[model samples]
Target chain A: AQSVAQPEDQVNVAEGNPLTVKCTYSVSGNPYLFWYVQYPNRGLQFLLKYITGDNLVKGSYGFEAEFNKSQTSFHLKKPSALVSDSALYFCAVRDYYGNNRLAFGKGNQVVVIP
Target chain B: DTAVSQTPKYLVTQMGNDKSIKCEQNLGHDTMYWYKQDSKKFLKIMFSYNNKELIINETVPNRFSPKSPDKAHLNLHINSLELGDSAVYFCASSQVEGGETQYFGPGTRLLVL
Candidate 1:
């Protein structure tokens, strides 16, 4: 079984400040990880994914995530924060050899204050 | 254009009633899925259909049935809806199976009284 954890329920950041939303996963075999963001009353939108290759994966809207193997973490990071970046973020992991289901975290609410 | 879409964005019904949520994807994807988001915002996969065939069925109750009449549509039908069954149901689709990015719909919020 594959699982993901976002320890923090919410993260507050001021505009122009760096932001980080933490995520970690446990899975069998190679892991196909993903990050998604959901706005209020809207569906989740794919931000980025880590399949194979680079540890630092860049995504849409100036967002990036670092996949740390030894730490078993995939934390999202941004150089600067914007009030519009406020939303709910989810972390997911899919086991390569398993039944092929994407297990998601409880989600983290990000509030970028202006 | 909307890649994936679900009908009846908000559904309010009484317990023991029957209801259905419809989903469709227009990204020419072969696989579609149904997911449930509880009040605490926990997302879990309930069912999946690839090319009109049932592929993934999680620990969902038998009262919930999914029907895929065609490749682009997968509808969920619930029999005797219970209060515990109330949640936001999202429909999504991916281009392929096993490790693929899924496109999600706006979701249908079901509230059972």
Candidate 2:
């Protein structure tokens, strides 16, 4: 079974500071990982995806994620946090060789303080 | 233009009543899916349709039925609404041939009284 775990329930960071939202995964073959963000009362928007390539994948809104095969982790990062970046983040994973279903982690609420 | 869209952004109804939520995607994708998000924000896949064919059906109850009129539309009908059925339902679509990057719709918030 493919699954993702987000350890933090909430992450607090000051504006202009680097922020990290932790995510780890377990899957059968190589994993296809994804990051999504959701604002209050809005649908989730795709941030980035790691299919197979360089370890670091850059995505929308200046967000990036690094895929660590040994650590089985794909952590979302932003060089400088903005107060508008405060939202819920979700990490998802799917098996590369098997089903199309994506297993999602419990979301993390990020608060960027001004 | 919205890529994926769902009707009845908010629904409040009594238990044992029947209701339906419609979803449409104009992205020209081959696969459409339904997802349920609980109060705690845990998302679970309920059903998926690919080109009007049932591709994935999770362990959902029989009271819930999903119908895909075409590749672009997937509608969910609930027979007997329950308190447990209250949650946010999302519709998403992706090109199955490509890497699985699903685009989501503005969710429909359903509240069963």
Candidate 3:
């Protein structure tokens, strides 16, 4: 079984400030990790993924995530936050050698203060 | 163009009633999935289909059934809906052989009274 944990319930960042959201995972074999963002009343949009190689994965809308194998963590980051960045963020993981199902973490609500 | 889409953005019904949610993906993907988001915003996978074949079925009650008539469509049917079943249901899809990123559709918010 694969699982993901997002430690924070919400993250508040002022506009133009750096933003970060934490995520951890537990999987049997290698982990295929992904990040998604959901706006209010909209579907989740694919942001980025970490399948193999490239610990620093850059994604849509100036978002980037670092995959740390040793720490069992994949933390999302943005250099500067924008008010439009306020949304729900989710982290997901799946066993590379296991089933196709993805285990998602409880989302983190990001509030970018303007 | 919308890659994935779902019908009936909001569903309000009484308990014990049956309802269906429809999903379609036009990204030429081979896999489709159904996920539920609870009131607390927790998301969980309920069912998945690969090429119109059931692939992943999580620990869910038998009252929920999923049907995939073709590669582009997967519909969910619920029987004897309970209050606990109320949640936002999202449909997603991915090309199993191409990449791992799954595209999602606007969720269907079901409210059971």
Candidate 4:
């Protein structure tokens, strides 16, 4: 079984400041990690993913995440935050050769203060 | 164009009522999935269909059933809905399978009263 954990319930960052949302995972085989964002009543929107090489993976809306193998972590990051970036962020994972189920984290609510 | 879409965006019904939510994907994906997001915003997969064949069925109750008339459409029906059954249902689809990005619908919000 694969699982993802986003330790923070809510993250607060000032506009133009750096933002980070921590994530960790536990899986059997190689991990396929992903990040998704959800606004108000909308469903999850893909942000970025880390499948193989390049520990630093960039994604939509200027968001990025780093895959730290030794730490079993994939933390989402943004160089400079915007008020519009405030949303619920999720970290999901599935074993590379495992079944088709992608386990999701208990989403972190981001509040980008203007 | 909309890659994935779901019908009855908001559903409000009483306990013991039966309701259905319809989902469609125009992305030409062969795999689709159903997920439930509880009040705590924790998402859990309920079922997945690949090319109209059931591929993944989690520990969901038998009262909740998923039907895929075609590869592009997947519908979910619930019988004897309980108060705890109220949650947001999201439909997602991915091309082929494993490790691919899954496009999601706007989600169907169900409220059991």
RMSD of 3: 1.1
Provide interface RMSD per model, one decimal. Answer: 1.2, 1.3, 1.9, 1.0
Q: Model 3: how far is B73 from its true place, Å?
A: 0.6
Q: Looking at model 4 chain B, which ten-residue stretch has the lowest summed lDDT?
A: B95-104
- lDDT for position B79 in model 2: 91
Model 1 per-residue lDDT at B81? 96
Task: Evaluate candidate 4 and give its CAPRI docking class based on DockQ.
Answer: high
Error of 3 at B89 (Å): 0.3
Ten-residue stretch with the least lDDT total in model 4 chain A? A94-103
lDDT of each: 0.94, 0.95, 0.94, 0.95
For residues A1-114, what per-residue lDDT tens digits would candidate 4 score against the true structure? 898888989999999999999999999999999999999999999999999999999999999999999999999999999999999999999998877799999999999999
**Which runs in model 4 stand beyond 4 Å of their true positions?**
none
Residue lDDT tens for model 3, A33-90: 9999999999999999998888999999999999999999999999999999999999
Error of 3 at B68 (Å): 0.5
* Residue B31 CA displacement from its true place in model 1, Å: 0.8
Candidate 2 C-alpha lDDT tens digits along A1-114? 999999999999999999999999999899999999999988999999999889999999999999999999999999999999999999999998766798999999999999
- The DockQ leader among the candidates is 4
Runs of candidate 3 with Cα error greater than 4 angstroms are B97-99
Candidate 3: residue pairs that collide: none
What DockQ results do all the predictions give, each relative to the true complex?
0.79, 0.74, 0.68, 0.82
Highest-lDDT candidate:
2
